[model samples]
Target chain A: MTADDGFDETLFELALRMGDNALILGQRVSAWCGHAPVLEEDIAMANVGLDLIGQTKLWLGLAGEIEGKGRSADDLAFLRADRAFRNCLLVEQPNVDYAHTLMRQYLFDAWHLPMLTALKQSAEPRVAEIAEKSAKEAAYHLERSSDLVIRLGDGSVESHERMQAALNALWPFTGEFVAPDDVDKAAASRGLGPDLSAIAERYNETTAAVLRDATLSAPADAPVRKGGKEGLHSEHLGYLLSEMQWLQRSHPGAQW
Target chain B: MTAAGTLPSEKDIWRWLEDVPDPEIPVVSVVDLGIVRDVAVDKGGAVVTVTPTYSGCPATAVIAMEIETALRKKGLDPVRLETRLSPAWTTDWISDEGRSKLKEYGIAPPVQGTSCAGAMKQANATVACPRCGSENTEEISRFGSTPCKASWRCRDCLEPFDHFKSF
Candidate 1:
């Protein structure tokens, strides 16, 4: 839903991208609530999910305001179809295994931390405010995820192989993080958001260092897979939406 | 014991708020945790400003309701609660008394001097054990039971404890 009709469509799209990314990933992480490999890890995953969900409120709340459609964060999150979501494909990838889940989180956190750090200096005050608060949490998330990546990637043969395979499978989806389209270009030109290319450069350096430390090798010049930003998602997103929106869709206005 | 028709002074309101315990950490008051940023009372009503310690802290709403209820019990009608995001809450804001209370309650207080901006960089910062008073503590996990805490264990006593995170 591009904000045509004279509204700041760039801001709306950028906010939606940020909000949707967090919402989808948060939902995925929250799925591990009672099913983690260990008790401590279960608690940790849930905490991360909670933090991301909390951030979704801030980002989507701003999106709704810019859209001027009287939509709240809940309405945007629970009611939107897969085609309406603006999150990158990386986050929407299924958590195939614990290693895959950790890799996905590490990859997203690597981009997310730098993205939020730059947004702290956003031209929009509301965006900057949310970024300031969110950056701290993102930093913590990155620290934990990167640490796990290093540990598991360098662990025993089985664990190392698992981590390596997960990295290879998820690597292609990361291209969308830095791949700029018209919306990203407009947002950067207007100074409403950070330049995706600059953030991409930082993302490469960060992920490279972490992968090196983890003893994991990524495919060089891997084919870039994109399109989630423009809402063309994988089959996985539809399943994710069905489960996440079931309660709200089945019985509208349901609340605890 | 304020006189009828006379609003309690801000100092008095602050004092009464000290008795309102945090829902999660009942041993410490919200004021002790630095959640209540400001309080003002006028003839119209009372307004209390609060900042959530974590973006996803579930206790935020409950803390607001508790504050309003505590104020209402004091005969302060038409109380208003405001949420402020700037000057994001930090463990540094936690009062000295809060730190001591947390320690006594078996949760290690955050190490002083760690800036919230550089929180992620201070991953290896030393945290003393509240159980055995040992400085040899190892972090079990960065994410703890609550958003503001981390799980740490003392080498000497070998007892697991929660450390109030620096951010």
Candidate 2:
């Protein structure tokens, strides 16, 4: 494909994948806005969620820009139907317990930090710029989430059990993150993305260390699910999109 | 309006902006916050490009308005403000002079370093205590009065201070 063929389809698809992850994770985290176990934690989670939403806006906006469509970030986020989103199933999972939330964050942050670090050197300047800015925020989120996992994993018997369960439950979804697709291969070859296979190694080391410090055992190897990077998502995405798009679909360009 | 060859210069416009303090941190001017990335004149009017300290920072709107107000007061009727997020705002963009001014005004400036360092390194970085000029300060909380700052307390002065976290 020629560079002038408009926005690179592969790049646009990659941007959507990145944007979807942020959007779905932001939605899941936002659910804890008023229900956090502690006030400080409530605010912290909400703040982190807001930061992710801001990131989603930027990435999604770039996606729209690449597509050369008239759609704005808001339109893409709230108007898109299910099966169109490219986010991993892990992000779309419901926020069941505080332990679940922390586990999800820890798992995702471990991968995100390295991914952004690599993207900072992307051939595309805009992608590199966004990655540079976002890497800093992701680092902080990873630190806080890692600390939480350790605390809960080593806490009272009941808390330790709960966190361990959370870790085990979410482990199955972790494989989907590093399962590369053709789009990912294309971007990686161009120096615009990370080699997920390599990232998986770093992710394993970091996550294992955190788990060990928390007195939790890492889950054994499991068959990984695939296709999220290609617009194939889990059942949860349909419900999420339905709720998120209700207002936008009903109103159709209605602005506040 | 001044005659074609007799108009005031860019320095005059910058001097006029001296009174425009940052909305969130009143001690420092918008220019000092490093938000004012560029200032130039176009055919229509004066154009100023600003990068917010963070995305969704509430102070952004107020800063834009203040810039417009300040320019209008200086007889620049047509002032345009643009916000850019591409390069992303870093606390390193803040000038050393601005850091000193923040200290003098009772606000701790952001510490210098790359964000890849873990939280422990971030917390241990020397942030001069706003009150007693002590280096024996500890971060009390990562989240502070606003999204941009962290609360710290000095071992010597025993007073809590807000350290603007580097974005």
Candidate 3:
């Protein structure tokens, strides 16, 4: 299913993986619309979701072209089954509360900004172009999430405890950020993208500094959870995909 | 009309595009926003290359349709709209006239050079109030009503306004 006629399958997987992360997380974030703690937060969350969904289109559009399939961004986003998704486990986790949502966003942005920055120099011209554009938005996202993580994590005792708990719960899935298998290694070796492991140090440093400021501790000796990168997602992803794909499934090609 | 078979000059085509106001900010034309990167007239038709202001801006489609509709009404049939991403769109590209129009419309124009990494680092850049001309404006939120803007309020005037994001 991953093979492509003219394009490298590794590149297609890379693009699909990137697109799926953005699409799933965007959908998750958008779910917070009208449900955030305050009006400003509600708008802010929706805006961030819009940006991610926008990036998803670029990534998925590139994926479709690489696959040489008639599929489009919409097809890949709304038609794919849960098992077919290539996003890491981190993004598919449930948004249990405001703290969990922010923590997830912060973790993702910390990795996303650096990843896109590295991908800006991708050997693939298209990848580089998309990365260049995406990195800017990612930077903005990271800046916002980092600030919030610090504010809420260090704010009140209740807020601090919630943030700490959220961090502890979410940290395990982060192991997937660096668990690059054969596909990632091949992409990195070919200069199509950066090595995931190489990006790990940077992600750790960035998140560490922000966590320190937030008065949160990284869970030491946390079990490393992997496999989402390999299309083995947590059960939460099935629920997310079911709801996200419902409209598309009910009325295929439904549009205004 | 120049002639039945003759095509309009690129400059003339640009002028026609200026008539296409941005669907979100109708005060400024797409050309004024500097999104209409290049206009090329060929035997086929006029191809207007546009760069999106934001990755997920919903106005992108509307703007494309508006451009096509405006051009087609001018008898320029088969207008091809192309999306360009390189050298990504920035508020710095907002023409001087566009900046002025934004202020006149009660929107704060982005500070020059804020699109770069240096300025992005400073999350709370002081923006002069569009309504009161007070530099005592505070950012209410980074994300605003539109993708390309941020919400801000003037301390002096107490009037909330949208600031076109540095991006």
Alpha carbon lDDT of residue A150, candidate 2? 96
- Which residue pairs does candidate 2 place in steric collision? none
lDDT of 3 by residue, A63-126 (tens): 9998886899999899988788999999999999999999999999999998999999999999
Candidate 3 clashes between residue pairs 3 or more apart in a chain or in different chains = none
DockQ of each: 0.65, 0.43, 0.72
lDDT (Cα, tens digit) per residue for candidate 1, span B41-137: 8674689999888788899889999999999888888889998877677788889999999999999998776846454355557888998898898
**For residues A29-72, could you state the per-residue lDDT of candidate 2 as single tens digits?**
98898899986688778778877887887789999988887888
lDDT for every model? 0.90, 0.81, 0.90
Show pairs that collide, candidate 1: none
Residue A238 CA displacement from its true place in model 2, Å: 3.1
Tens digits of per-residue lDDT, candidate 1, A1-256, equal: 2445868878888899999999999999999999999988998999999999999998999999998989999999999989999999999899889999999999999999999888888888889888888888998888889999999999999999999999999999998999889988887777777889899999999999999999999988889988899999999999999999999999999998
* Predicted chain A of candidate 1: TM-score: 0.97
- Misplaced by over 4 Å in model 2 are A1-7, B1-6, B82-87, B96-107, B113-116, B119-123, B126-137, B153-161
Worst 10 residues of 3 chain A by lDDT: A1-10
> Between prediction 1 and prediction 3, which has the larger DockQ?
3
TM-score of chain A of each: 0.97, 0.96, 0.97
- Give the share of true interchain contacts found in each model: 0.57, 0.28, 0.66
